[model samples]
Target: MRYLVHYVEDVTERVHAEAERARLVAALAAERGQLRAALLQAMTPMALLVGPEHRLELVNDAYKRVSGGRDVTGLTYREAFPELEGQPFFDIQDRVYATGEPWAATAVPVRYDRLGAGLEDAYFDLRYEPVRDAEGRVFALLSYGVDVTEQTRAHLAAERERQRLAAVLEHLPVGVTFAEAPAGRHSVSNPAAVAIWGVVPASPEVAAYSRDFVGFRPGPGAPGSPEEAARRIASHEWPLARALAQGEVVQDELVEIERPDGARRLVSLSAAPVRDADGRVDGALVTSVDVTERERLLAESEAARARVTAVLESIGDAFYAVDAEFRFTYVNRRAEALWQRCREDLIGRHYWSEFPAAVGSESYRMHHQVMSERRPVHYETISPLTDLWIDVSIYPEAGGGLACYFRDITARKTAEAAREAAVARAEGARAEAEQANRGKSEFLAVMSHELRTPLNAIGGYAELIELGIHGPVTEAQRTALARIQQSQRHLLGLIAGVLDYSRVEAGAVTYRLADVPVGEAVAEAEALVAPQLRAKGLGYAWSGAPPELHMRADREKLQQILLNLLGNAVKFTRPRDGVPGRIEVACTVDEERVHLHVRDTGVGIAPEQLERIFEPFVQADQRLTRAQEGVGLGLAISRDLARGMGGDLTAASVPGVGSTFSLTLPRA
Candidate 1:
C-alpha cells in the first residue's frame, strides 16, 4: 500500500513538472515572435544578425525603404552600399562590433544605388550595437537608425539664415541694437547703433562697454540726469531693457542724448520683443533715428509765423485774407470790427457765408475779377447789413489768395448827395423867376400901347385950344385950360414910361452897339433929367469923368439908364428939412469895364431894400399913399437895358445918408 502511495506522488510530481515546462516554452515562443515582429514592422530602420565580416543577415521593411528598395539582406555592407565603402560609417560600425561596444552617430550621411531610381544621398541618426550569446560572448552586430534627412537639412538651413541675418544687422544704415532677455545683456549692436548710443559695440559684460554707455545724458526737461540716465540703461530700466525683460513693445520714444562731440542729438527710438520657438521672450530688437535737424527747422518755422502775425495785427486798415476758395484765412481787429463779429468767428469761414447778401454784389464781383485777372481792384459798394458805403481795394496775393483793405465812406457820400439836391432846387427856382418876368413884360406892353395914344390926343387938343384959332378966352378959362393940359402931359409921360419898361423887360429893345463916349452920354442924361431936377430944386454935381473913357454899349440905352437913375434921385429929394437933395454923376474906367455912377444924397435907400429896388414892381416905399408918383418899373427897366448892352447895374445905399447906382459896361 505504501508503494502505491509513493507511485501516485511521483506521477503527480511529473505531471506538474511537465505542465510548468510547457508554460515556459509558450512564453519563450511568444517573446521571440514579439521581437521579430517589432523589428520587421518598426517605423525606424533596423537590421539584425549582422556578422563581424560586415555582412547583413536580417533587414526590416523600414531598412528596405531607406535603401530605396535595394535587397540588402544577407549581403555584406560594402556589397549592399558600394558608394559608402570609403566613408567613416562602416569604420564606426566595425569598431563597435570588434570592441563589443555600442556606438551612436547623429546626422550621418550615406549614399546608395536604388532599385529603380538613381543613386541618392540620405541622412540618419544611426546606432551600432553587438549582440552577445548567454555566456556574454558577442556573435553578431545589430544596427538601427532613424531617418532624420528632413531634420538635418532643416538644421543646416537655419544655421545659414542666422549667419545672413547677423551680417545684415551689422551693416544696416539705421541704428540697430539687440538685448538678451532676463540676462539684461545689451550685447549686440551695429556701427550706427554704437554711434547713436555713444557706447562701444562689444559684449555687455565688459566694463568699458557699460562705461561708454554711461556718457549718455538725458535731454532737457527729461525725467533723469546724466548719472540716472546711465543707471537706467545699465539696470534695464529703459525701454529697450523693458521690452526684453517684460516682452513689451515700445515705439517712437523721443529722447535726446549727448554725442561724443559734446553736442546734443535728438533721437526717435522703437523696440520690439524677439521670441523663441517656445513663444518665450528671448531678446529685443531696437531701432533709432536722429531727428535733430528736423526739430530745429520746426522751431524756426514757428518763430517766423509769430513775426508775420505781429505785423498783421498792428495794421490800421480793416484787413482780411482769404484763400482761392474765398474761405477766410486771416482777419485783423479792424476787419472784425467792420464785420461786427469776432475774428475767431470770421477766420476759416467762407466770405459769402459771413456776408450772405454780398454774394452777387459789386464788392464780390470786383474780388472775383481781381482773382481771375491776377491784378488789383478798387471799388465802392453799399453794405446791405449796415447800410454804409464802403471803399474797398482787393489785391491778389502770391499763393492763389486775396488780400482786402476797406473803410467806410458813408458820411462823404451823404454830404455829396445833399449838395446835389440843393443845386437842383436852386435851378428850379431860377426857371420859375424867368417865367414870371415874361408874364409881367407882356402885361406892361399891352397897357402902354392901349393907354398912351388916348392920352397923347388929349394933350394935342389941349394945346390947340390954348392956341385959340376959334378966338377969345378969359384969364380963368386960360388957367383952366393950362391945368387940363398939364394933366394931359403927365398922363402921356406915364404912358411913355410904361412903353419903354415893357420893351426892355421883353428883351425886344433894339441896341446899336457902338462906341459911346462916357462924358457925352452923361451930358445927354443930365439934360433929360435937368427939368425934374430943377423943379424939385435938387443940387447936382459931376466929377471923376475922363474925356477919353469909352464904353462898348448902345448909345440910347446908356442915356436912358442914366436918366432914370438921376430922375429917381430928384423925385426922392423933396427938399427935406429945407435942404435940397444932391445928385452926382461920375465915370470910372478900368482895363476891362467902364463904370457910370449916379449918387443921391436925399432919402437914401434902406440897407435891406437895395437889392429889392432892382426887381420889377418893387418900390422903396411900398405904401399906396407914398409921395412917389410912378410905378416901380423905372429902376428895373434901367438895370435890364444896361445888362442887355453887355453891362451891369449895382446899387449901394445907407439909410438917411446917401445912395449910389453904378452902371458898369464892358470897355471896347
Candidate 2:
C-alpha cells in the first residue's frame, strides 16, 4: 500500500478530459438531430422518410399538416395515404426512389381519407425527387407540392360566364343596337335590329342609311312616320340621336320607320347614353318594340266607337248612361228630345242636377239598384219634370254603371186609365143588375110559394070532389071535376118548377156533398121518371152502368139532374111521324170524372132553339102547336144544381135524331 501511494499523481485531469470527450459526443449528436428536424420541418411539401420495407421512418410537420395532423408514423405509403393507393402518386414516388430521377405534375389532385378530417378534393402542383446517399443510390423520396385549387376554379368560372353572355346576346327577342353618340355611327346590332331596319349597318354608321330608312318623330297631320320624313333634320332628333347628343335617357318614345319595301312600322323606342370609363357619354344603347299591331287595334276600336255612337243617335227609344257617381256619360238624341235639352247639355252633368225631381223617384232608385246588384231592372215611372209616364229599362254595365232606355208612355197610360174607369162603371152597373135580378128572384119565389099554397088547396078540393067526398056527382060533373084536377096538378107543377129555378138562379140552394154511388143514384132517378115515360108510351133503356162508379157530389142534386133530363125526354119523345119514342140512360167512369148520359129518340130540339131551352120560362115549342105543359124552369134549375154539386150539364141534339144530355162530375 505504501509503494502504490508513493507515485499517485492527481488523476482528476484525466477524468475531466474523459468526461469532456463524452459530453462533446452527446452535444454533437443532439445538434445533428436538431438540424435534421429543422430541415424536414422547413419544407412545405408533405415529406416523410421510408425504410427499405416501405414503412414510414420519419415524418415532418408538413407531413402532419397534409394528413390533417393525423399520426402516420411507421405507416407504409399505402397505409398513410390510402386515398392515393392504386393511383399515379404512389407509382411516381416509387419510380423516383427506384430510378433516382425527378418527376413533376401540374394540377395533381388528391383526397385525404381519415376520420374527422373533412377530406375534400384538393389540386396541387407536385414534384417528386429521389433522395440518394453518397453512393448515388436512391434510398428515399422527397415530394414538393403547391395548392392551386383557387386558380383552377377561377379559370373555369370565367369560361362558363363567357358562354352564358354569348347565348343571351344571340337569342334576345327585341331589337338592340349601340351607336356612337351625336354622330349616329353604328357600333353593333343584334339580329333583330338588323331585320327591323331592313339593312345591316354596311358602313358601321347609322347615317349611312338614307333618310327613308330611319324612324322619324311624329308631327301634326301624321298618325305615324309618313311616307317621307317630316324633314331630314327631324329624323336626326329621334330617340337614339337625342340620347347620345344630350347624354340623357329617353324612354318610351314613339317613332315610325319605313322599311325599304315601302312598309310602315310603328315602334316604341327607348334609349340611354352609354358612358365610357371616364363617365363621359360616348355612345347610346337603344331598344325598339314593334307596335304596328297595337296601332291597328286602336284604329279598329275608334271605328267601332263611331258606329256605336251612330246607332245610339239614330235609335228610336231614349237612351242614356251614367257612371257609378250618377254623373251622365252619354245621352242619345231621343233622350235629349224627351228631355227638351241638347245631348251635350245633359252629358257630363249629374243626373239629379239635370232632373232634380227624379232624385228620389223610382227611376233613380232603379239605376242605383242595377249598379249595386249588377243586373238589369225594368220599371214604369212618371217623370215629375215633364209629368209624363215613362217606361224604363235599366241595364248594368261592366264599368260599374247603369244604362237606361225609356220611352214616354203618358198617352198609353191615359188610355189605360180611361178604359179602367169605363170597366169600373160597367162592373158597377153589372152589380146593380145582379141585385135587381136577385130582388126579382126573391119576389118570384115568394109569389110562387103563395100561389103553390092556394093551388095545392084547389087541387085537394078538386080531388075530393072527384072522389064524391062532398056529394054524389053525375057523369058530366065527374068528367068536369077530373079535368079541374088535372089542371090543378099542372098548375102546381109549374109553381114548384118556378120556385126551384128561382132558388137556383139566386144561389140560395144548399147541398150536402159526399161520395155517392153513381149507379144507385141513376137507378133512383130512372124510377122517378119511369111513370111519366110509360104514360107517354116511350121505350126506356138503361144499360152499361159501372157498378162501383162513384162521384163527389150531392146525392139529391144528382138525382134531380137525372130526373129533369128524363122528364124532358118523356115530354119531348112522344110519337113523332109515327115513330115510337125511345129514351136511354147510361153511366160511365173515367180517371177524373163520372158521366151520366140521358139520350132521347124524340122530336129532337132544333139547333137554333136548343140553347134557349134551358132558360127559365123558355120552351122548345113556344108556339101554339106545342103541347108541352110545364115551363123550361126545370131544365134551368137542374143545370144550376148540377154545377153546385161540382158537375156540369151539357146538351147536344139534332133535329129528327136524338138529344143527349150529359152530366159530368168529379170522380171520388
**Of the candidates shown, which would achieve the greatest lDDT relative to the real structure?**
1
lDDT of each: 0.80, 0.78
CA RMSD of each candidate after superposition: 36.4, 17.5
Per-prediction TM-score: 0.42, 0.55
TM-score of 2: 0.55
Q: Judging by TM-score against the true structure, name the best candidate.
A: 2
What does candidate 1 score on TM?
0.42
Where does model 1 exceed 4 Å of error? 1-437, 469-474, 509-512, 533-538, 574-581, 622-625
Tens-digit lDDT track for model 1 on 1-668? 35544442458878888999899889878976898889888888898856677788778998898887887888888788778777787788778878998988798876665434876666789898898876988878788889888898898899989989888877887888776665435577788887776665454444444434323434544566778777777775666556766788988766776654566788877889999999999988878877777778778989988987788778777889999999999998887887788989878989898889887878878888998999998888897666789888899999999999988898988998999999999999999998997887788789888887787787787778778855777789889989998888777777777878878767678889998887888888888888888787788888956677778998877877887888788877656677777888887878899888888887788778887998877898998799777767788888888888888999998888888889899997
Tell me how candidate 2 scores on lDDT. 0.78
| Model 2 residue pairs with clashes | none
lDDT of 2 by residue, 515-595 (tens): 988778877987787788778788888886666777899887787788778887887787878877899888777889888
Give me the overall lDDT of model 1.
Answer: 0.80
RMSD of 2: 17.5
